[model samples]
Target: MSLHESVLCSTLPSQGTGTLTLHDLQTGTPLALFKHTSSSSRCVAVIPTRAGLGGVAIAAQVDKAVLNVYSFQKDQVLLKCVLPERLACTAVDKRGLLCAGGTAQGRIYLWEKLASGALCNVWDAHYRQVTTLAFSHDGDALVSGSDDAGISVWSVSRLLDGDAQNTPVPLLNFSDHTLPITDVVVGIGRFPSCRLVSASVDCSVKLWDFSTNTLLTTFLLPRPISHVVFDATERLIFAVANGPEGDIYQVNLLRRRDDHVEAVGGAGVNDIIRLGMENKNEQDPASGKISVGEEVTVLSLSLTSSLLLAGTVAGFVHVYDVHSHQRLRSISVGAKITNVYAMLRPPDLFGHTSLVAREGSIPVRPIAPLQRTRATEWEGKEVGVLLAPFGKETAESLINYPSDELQRDFALLLHTSPSNVREEPATATNARVAELEAEISHLRGQLGRAKGVNDAMWEAMVRKVVAQEKEKNNADEGRIKKKGKKDH
Candidate 1:
């Protein structure tokens, strides 16, 4: 049996009890729900188990700290475990062998899975309130970030291999950020060595070379980063920032530049309203305008890296096309979204399809570029006929499906094979080729600029290190002279 793509969202209660809801990401339908007896849930972590099974660990606040672990086979929960701890955050290793939880008081506890579906062998790891934790690709290392602005990389093997008498030390300690660290993720790419990335509340993101324990580069964003998810290729970072009017940015990892893609908050209400009016006449009275001061609180990226899901404080989940940056759909969940996790189906579940299948396919003559004309001229007019044989009722039926189903069909259409789509005119094909060439040229220039910046930063670091070494030598000479005078 193959697993299906799903999304797990933890809700923060506005006036009632909190709950964890799971939905099929492809269709946006509720799959399962687990009600929490507590008032609020803080963080969640997913652990991938054998035979395609998985488990979710949630930290909820009650009279005492509690960690609720739910084991799942596919879309249903199989088992649950309630542990004692006021965990601020949690992380699990790739193999689900190790689980780590960060506490509100800055302590880290590690747990090992047992055969009885329980987590055991708990141990302390961090001294300060840990904000985020992530396992390395190989599962041999664990990286943690804390409110103290310190990052520690621990040797998972050593930590697990040691006995109760011995404690393990961190392999590297990074303390460069001035503010609290919000998120930390281990990098995955075609790089020669291991890399780690950290986002801080100080409005900066730092990339580190784990092998050398050196900071590789830093990127400054417009606002403090609230959440971040890397693309499948790890070449792009999709991030949501903290503010009343939250904005989403696509940051090129290699070029180190931020591109504002979409505005999900109340600042873009006018644009959204205009779009709604253009799409429909006499908008539904029940669909009121998005209020001012709504903030996007959570973000998740689909496995294909083709869709982005953003959840707001106003109980709305907006999905956007990663390539076009267009809003695809907005869903109401009826509660503030505290966490959003996108789970991908196993590769065996679906046939292999090219992500850019339509890149060279049918560029059906751009609908005359949509000239600005009077609405009365086109209203209720059949300006064009469908190329394929389709009845009016069939077209209306396709359009009348629920929004989630329509969105799923749209995604499927994007993934259709190139051979299935109609071919474009020669003139249009040549124009598209030219556009691609220009884009490639622009990217090359950006790559060169990025390299130049990296080189300059490396030189500056060398100079600073040399100055420090010279100062240390002078101090040593002064101490030697003082010793000689004392001897005389």
Candidate 2:
């Protein structure tokens, strides 16, 4: 009972099927429709089952190597999961715990129990095609983005706990875009402190701090951005500009510019805010010449109606007004929009559809079973006698401290107290026993990067089912050698 109204999710990339819509930005309507769900370009994900209303998990869209989770207390699109790569994008974790995916061969799965579809870490984050993953409003870092122009970050508790002496790498990789990564966003701060903002098809955007990997700023825009949102007081960004008169820039991270006109990677140069699109006398902040056609892609941003949604490859979405640059409505959903999602849509996912559920809503929890299970293993018995005797007590003693006193002693060892308390507080039971010894060192680095992403995704689904059973026994020995050369 919280998460009241304001929706507009979307997704598209049609190759023959797609639809994940939710729209209703003050009367253009479309409230719910999951449709056949093929969606891949800008692969989807909604997640919110606890950051607001108490239900929603939507991953919506994907086919090769399946996937289809859609829950809001379920109706018809039961959960699906069958992966072995082929995902391409989807990141959740706004309080809905975790769920990520990005592949097409550049791994990064992480799932921390999405209803037991287990597996919680897998890496090899990018050499090509990861294209965006974000998650850091306290989901403990993770920031991806690839196609090879790079941008790493990770550290979801060092990927569930990595070991071999804490080897989980990537607390920032960056690479300074030589033209790939397209959108990132991430900062609503919290967790090693945030601030990311990416975007780049080379027309730059940069900005970073990703908890001290530091870069800070860069904007150089004009076109080639194709999707980038952040406004709801994250100090305005709202990009999009991709082609055929696409326009829609706006950068303003609150001014700061020694006259920016060129400043590649030594990052620093800001002030951009001029996103008033639709040919308002063609205001040229370097010829963005507003029009909203030929491409645009996607942009969301409605933090409870500061509205700025923008989607289009020519199927419309428009709606601006981020402080009166005005346009307020366009809607169209006719196809081409790749991912919009302005957020907060939990009326129990509009009650139901095609299978009925409405009445008082809230019930669905179905998830585990779209194939590829095999992850069990977590023995217990208090993990063999609540122990702690690991070789030589990790001797690396040589401290000088002061990374702000090690982030204030790691925010006072992750403080915790009022949990609807009536009695809990010996310093919240020693911060819940130091969060159960960091969940037993994230289940001992989840058996190593969550069993190396579920045993290399079941060893790539058993080598794609044994190469389709040796291509069906070499087409049955080439049709019995064409029937022994047609019986000679």
In angstroms, give how far residue 376 of model 2 lies from its true place: 13
Q: Model 2: residues >4 Å from true position, as ranges?
A: 1-27, 30-55, 58-90, 93-111, 117-151, 155-161, 164-167, 175-247, 250-286, 289-298, 301-353, 356-363, 367-377, 380-488
What is the C-alpha lDDT profile of model 2 across 76-186, one tens digit per residue?
576566676667787877765567778867877776644445565676777778877888877888888887888888778778666423336886687866888878887
RMSD of 2: 29.4
The C-alpha local distance difference test score for the whole of candidate 2 amounts to 0.64
lDDT of 1 by residue, 338-447 (tens): 77777753221112231112222111111111111112232354332224235423222321335544455445545654454455669998999999999999999999
Error of 1 at 200 (Å): 0.8
List the candidate 1 regions with Cα displacement exceeding 4 Å. 1-4, 37-42, 48-63, 73-84, 114-127, 189-192, 255-293, 345-414, 418-488
Which candidate number has the best TM-score? Answer: 1
Clashes of each: 2, 0
TM-score quality measure for candidate 2: 0.30
C-alpha TM-score for every candidate: 0.60, 0.30
